[model samples]
Target: MKRLPPLPALHTFLVTAQCCNFTRAAEQLHITQGAVSRQIAGLEDHLGYELFIRLARGLELTAEGREWLPKIQQVFDLIGDSVEQIGAKRETLQLKAPSCVMRWLLPRLMQWQRERPDAPVKLTASLQHGVDFQREQFDAAVIYGTAPHDLPAALHMFDEQLTPVCSPMLLKGAPGLNAPADLQQHLLLHPTHDDQDWALWLKAADLRLSNIGSGQHFETLDQAMSMASHGTGVAIGDWSLIGDDLNAGRLVTPFDLKVKTGLGYYVVAPDRPEPSAKLRELMVWLVEQAHTR
Candidate 1:
């Protein structure tokens, strides 16, 4: 069997490789830059090869470092997975999802808990597109996108459709938006970096407006939906995220038209040799809920 470098040194090396700078890696790891440098040097000495090339500008990974980074990450992830499996006696299941999904799912999860009172759940709401299930403690995640690769198990929840929505207040004002073309006169709240939803929906509706991109920008779908709920402006909403809000009258679809983007919500579980039965039950419940709605 091949000997391995010290765990601390290997961790420091991985952080340094990720940030490509000792100072940034140290800051993230909550250690001093000098300590980071020392660990990297120790790791390189143990391995008998320089992992990083120190330049005046900053640290850059050597060819060997670049090749080893993913392998090291995988090792740490595997260690975390093993620890989680060993400590699986605890009944709580850690689940992660985007904030928008959390907003929609949290209220509904009461039913999940009620149905299976013995199976407790822990919800972690994050904006991250995908959770590193092996490295992170999340037993499963509800991710919004095309089917993510490398998961041991995945269930398609629902297809996503982009539809324009806003508070009822937007409909009462002068020059009110009665038609899709009238959207040109109001603000278009963007959920992400681009106005792809608005552009796609408009093209699908056959309404050409150059100024459709003009509007408020937010980093997450939840933020955009909130702004629209409060009558700030019209925003395109993901059907999977804003279905409850739409039904509750918090938001109203200004147009009946919807454009399917092919991307959808998926429940994903980590690639484990023996998958947890509890997580499988939760995944099944999620799919059932998606279908019933």
Candidate 2:
């Protein structure tokens, strides 16, 4: 077996390469600038090649150093990810979901906490619609898609029922939205840049508007729904996600029609022969809540 370079020197090199300055790297490592210089020198001598090109302002990586940075980064990332997975809290179930599901998921999570205080759940709301169990530490995730074929185990939460929603004030105002064709007079709010949600609903409704592509776009459905609640514009919202807003009269569906996009929200878990009892209980509870709500 070949002898490896010192771990400390490799770490120092990684930090220095990232910072591109010995002083900054030393400050981060809480070591003297001289020590940082010595470590880099030792590492270069061991490798028999210059890793950095000293510059007037700071430092620049040589061709060799640039190539080595990503490999060294991957090595540290693997070590960190492994340590985190092994040392993670076992009792608390880490759950991830997209921001759009917060309206529906948050209430149920609180209810779950109240009902079963012994089984704790930690939630992480992100813009991402999917999770990678191999790379992430989450125990399970709520993903929005047509199907959960990629997951080892998944439970259907609810189908995505899309319809136009807006504040009650908009309905009572002039340029009234009484029918699908009336949409031409009002501003449209889209959850995505492509306006796919609105397009899908429109296609289902068998209504074509000249300004289908024209609208204010948002990165997430949550943003578009929030704007709609404030009477900014008519936003295409998911029926399952906007139930609370509708009940509270914060937002209202102008038309009685709803279109199912074939896509749905599902609670997915990593590949495992047998999942924990708590995980199964939680997934079942989520499905129940979706049905009841």
Candidate 3:
């Protein structure tokens, strides 16, 4: 059998490549920037080729590095999945959720941990809105959209209610946002490239703006909401997901109106004749939390 490169060096290379900066990678890895540099250098020497082209500002992956990245990620993912499926880790409930719901889901998970320290939950956040239980290892998932018909159990959490949210500073600014029409005077942050969320809200409000697609756009609702909280622009946010932000005054609703998109978030589990008592208990607790929120 052939010898493999040091696992620590490979892990360091992976983190450095993902961050594109030795300093940031060092911060994430809890090591000195010099140590990160050394690991990358060692990995490059072992591979007999340079993986990254270090620039003054940051690093850029060489062709070889780019090609090797996904393969390395898969290797690590498989290793992680294998470890979690065996022994004591297997008893922990694995949950997957879209990143859009972090504002709501994270706090609840923390509360759940406090209440039931014995029943641990391993959460994996992803960009994907839906999950395929057969292919994924999660015991349950928080899905956004219409209820999934194929799942054995799908517990409705809340409806998708869209409303404009921004920093409280926007409320005091000129051309005050007294009504939906006042949006024309301010920037509109779109959570998607297609600007569908903003469009949906506008259509529901029976209002239209010529520059609907004109402001900053983000890849996720969370990013748009973050910018909105900073007073960058007004974002069409899911009302349920931004409760914490609203409570903390980091964001505020500009209008009282909320438009229901006929979509919602649900806690779904795969088809199983009899789920574990712990899984059932977690799902019930999640639904109760959702209702209370």
Highest TM-score, which number?
3
- lDDT string for model 3 (245-285, tens) is 88888899978889899989999888674567888899999
lDDT per residue, candidate 2, 1-293, as tens digits? 64477566799999999999999999998767876886788678778999999999999999999999999999999977964774364488889998779878898998998898677888888878888888898889999887878786999999999999999999999889999999988899987768788888898889998876778876567667766876878999999898888888989999988998888999999976466899889999999989986
The local lDDT score (0 to 100) that residue 267 gets in candidate 1 is 90
Model 1, stretches more than 4 Å misplaced?
A: 1-90
In every candidate, how many clashes are there? Answer: 0, 0, 0
Off by over 4 Å in 2: 1-90
* Each prediction's TM-score versus the true structure: 0.66, 0.67, 0.72
Better structure of 1 and 3 per TM-score: 3
Give a tens-digit lDDT track for model 1, residues 158-262: 888889999988899866999998988888888777978888888899889767657877656766776687687899887766778878788888788888998
For model 3, the local distance difference test gives: 0.84
Models ranked on TM-score: 3, 2, 1
What's model 2's lDDT at 234? 94
State the weakest 10-residue window (summed lDDT) of model 2.
Answer: 82-91
Evaluation by TM-score, superior candidate among 2 and 3: 3
CA-only RMSD, every prediction? 14.8, 15.9, 11.2
Report lDDT (Cα) of residue 227, candidate 3.
Answer: 67
TM-score: model 2 vs. ground truth:
0.67
Over 4 Å off, model 3: 1-90
